[model samples]
Target: MYPSSALGEFLRSRRARLQPEELGLPGGVRRRRVAGLRREELAPLAGVSVGYYIRLEQGQAPNVSDEVLDALARTLRLDADERRHLHRLARIPQAQTSLPPTEVLRPGLSHMVEAFTDAPAIAVGRRGDILAWNPLAHALLAPHWPVMPTGRPPNFVRIDFLELAFARSLYADWAAKARDDVAYLQVSVSNFPGDEQLLAFIAELKELSPEFRELWAEHPVSNCATIAREYRHPQVGAMTLAAELLRPPDDEGQGVTVFQAEPGSVSQDRLRRLAELTSGSAA
Candidate 1:
């Protein structure tokens, strides 16, 4: 079966996440069979006709003006990234998603990643495939895998959901990480609406993992470029690192994520120990 239209699904999910009471709607939040503001309620608040809003939500409205979308965004109380996503869904033409032919990290970027010898760094492709990583990154992220991966590469989504034992053991807050992964995937889907392959990727994940299925249905969208992550390394104990996702100016589809701890902090010391331990083990 075909997936629901991304535009329509996104709108419905956003609407369902909001509550009448939160928006200070009249009638004092009576119990209802349906959740969130109904089309009739939302339309007036967004300064559009109920029928028109319904049409937009159903993906029937075409060439919708930015002013109207902005009104909808404001009324929905969408965050900056979400507002941008809504605009893209309303205004951009449908196109198939295309990724680079090679999964190899760019030469310059790979060098940069390696230059972060003290910190953990990884390069990933658009679809979450791990392209390259430094030794510390290898030890920190996926010690279960080879130093240089062969055959199938490690993936962010697969590693987080499919490798439950490892993920649960590794992250201090596995639930938060799951949300981040699913939301980032939504960002990818929104970037390329009507992409069958991307839809299939979602379908496969849903089929395999109930948690992923539930989160995917929630339709959360986030573009987290930097986040403080807590890692419970089996070898070196607990540490917190700021993971910064950097995309090259020339390439939007690939990113280098560097993990570094605050100077003079306990986490920084643990990270150093991890680097030494991993290197010694390899030696």
Candidate 2:
């Protein structure tokens, strides 16, 4: 994908969400044609000419200065992550190397997951593929799905958005979770624009799921670190868990995710029972 196109889309999406009155601009009595601040209105507030802003929005502006980018970022109320993404898109190189290779869990990392008998911990690759998981995590996340062979990884995005019916049943707030997954994928794309496999996965999702396509078009980006998720496990009934995402020190795109419940809470009790059940079955 062209960086210019990505930058333009991101800018336009951000602009469309801001109301004119939010920036202290007067809302005229006449109905506005566009949803948010018009291009003309945004240009002056961002300290740039209307023609230049138009060119920038149309992906025709070249050699955009830092001052102008910062001005536009401020005008659009971009957060730190969004600002970084903006910079990455605007400073694209003519040639980009392929994404780094898929990460495998170190022996120590694998042992760590084995040690977490009660909690659910899993390692995932950049493309949302499950790299490694303990029995508890496997039981919690994909009890009903068929297991892939040893070297092959199961993609969470495909299961959640396209093929698996159990995914809808797994998450209590399916829509919100689905959107977060898409947004996370969006951020990953900005980081690795040259990954053909990643691009193909995105294309397949767009063709398979209308919801995924709609969410992808919004250009939402995030680095999800902590989240409270509710899951309705087939064996455990209902439980709310806190998910913590950790990137290994040596790995850039791979992450280790752990799920836990409050001590002595009902959810924790349920988790204990679920773990026992999985352990018993494994033996």
Candidate 3:
């Protein structure tokens, strides 16, 4: 979808989730063709002309003022992240949709990922594609799929959705993790609105997984960083791993994320065992 299309879709979806009664309107779902407030109701509340608001929703409005956007954001109950997404879709210049070259692993970062023997560390490209990973990360995240000699890299979003059985076995809260995967993609797209390759990738995944389609339509917004990953590891039983996301100053939509088990915790012990198993096999 184009940036305007994304903008329109986002506005429509957010409005659909709200009820007229919630805003102290008299209708109470009366005379309402849809579930949410109508354009007329929203326009007046946000201090804009009804025609202008309609144009904005349809992506026909060439320009929108920040004051208006702020009002609309407030009316729609948008969070900080969602508000940022709204602004970008409305104002930021669109990046070229042509597929860029394959993402290369930066030198020091690849070494950095490999250096983390005690924890799961990975170099993550856009949309959570695995660029480089240490042995523990390999064992922790995608043990079933052996590392490819050469091909498209393994993407965590695709794995989290299409590989349902494995994901469920890995994450204690599989449903939340699946939703988070979708949301991360949503946030990433704000950087390259209407990117053909990225859009096609997401569209294909949505087609492949019904669960993904359901979550994608919700338009959840979040970055890839996770506070904790509650793992139900088949080998080590259970582990609650904390994450630290590393984005360099010259970030090009790539970063390193490490998952660590707290020192002296049972999770740390299990992680050590997992590490031994992964490294010993390699040796």
Candidate 4:
């Protein structure tokens, strides 16, 4: 979808989720044809004209002021991330810059991953490509696939959506994870519109996976930094771990994701067991 349409859809979706009563507005005696606050009802509350609000929601408003955007965000009760996304969508001069090529993990980053002997750590590029990963991460995320050399990268998006059986076996909530991946991709595409590799990757995914096509149409945008993910491992059974995403300084679009379990928990015990199994297999 175009950025303007995305902005409109996001506004409509958020507006539809709020109730008149929740906004401290009296529910009128008249029967409502649509859900949530009407444009006229919301306009006054946001200190904007009904005509202007309608134009904004219809993606026809040009050069929307930051004051108006912030007012709308507050009126809609948007969370921090959602508010940022709204600003990105509504801002004028939506400049598109070509992103740099994928980066390999620096030596210090490789060392950092190695230090996490008990945790699974991987370095990922902008387009969800696995740039470098520690042995534990390899065992956790892709034991079947060989770890490639520095220049070549393995992509998480392809493996998750295109390889259904593997993805279903790996993630306990495969559908949710898949949707998150697609949503992240959508946000990435919006941010880096001039990235040819990203465009090609998305085109390839859309052509290959009908499921991806359906999810992409929903226009979900998210930048999830931490997630509680469940993995069904052949050696360690079911384990729930918190995946933390860390972007290294000056790494551009690359990020280091580390998965860890609570100390002294059953998940931790499983992780330790998995580490031992991976070590033994390597030996």
How many steric clashes between backbone atoms does each model show? 0, 0, 0, 0
Supply candidate 4's per-residue lDDT for 161.
92
Give the poorly placed runs of model 3, Cα more than 4 Å off. Answer: 27-31, 92-101
Please write out the lDDT profile of model 2 over residues 148-219, one tens digit for every residue.
Answer: 445557777887987647888999999888888887787777777777677778888999999899998888
**Candidate 1 all-Cα RMSD:** 2.1
TM-score of each: 0.92, 0.90, 0.92, 0.83
Candidate 1 lDDT over 63-89, as tens digits, reads 788999899889888999889888767
lDDT of 4 by residue, 132-239 (tens): 788889999988888665445778888999889999999999988998898778766666556777878888888999999887766566786899989999888999
In model 4, residue pairs whose N, Cα or C atoms come closer than 3 Å (at least 3 residues apart or on different chains), thus clashing, are none
* lDDT for residue 240 in candidate 2, whole number 0-100: 95
Residue 45 of candidate 1: its Cα lDDT? 86
Cα lDDT tens digits for candidate 3, 1-283 = 5565778888888998988778988775346677687888899999999999989988887679899899999999998888988887787454445547576778878888878777899898766689998878888999987765268888898899888889998999998888777777887777765456677789898789889988888888766565687998888889999878788888667888999988999999999999888888899
Give the total clashing residue pairs for model 2: 0
- What's the best-to-worst order under TM-score? 1, 3, 2, 4
Better of 1 and 4 by TM-score: 1
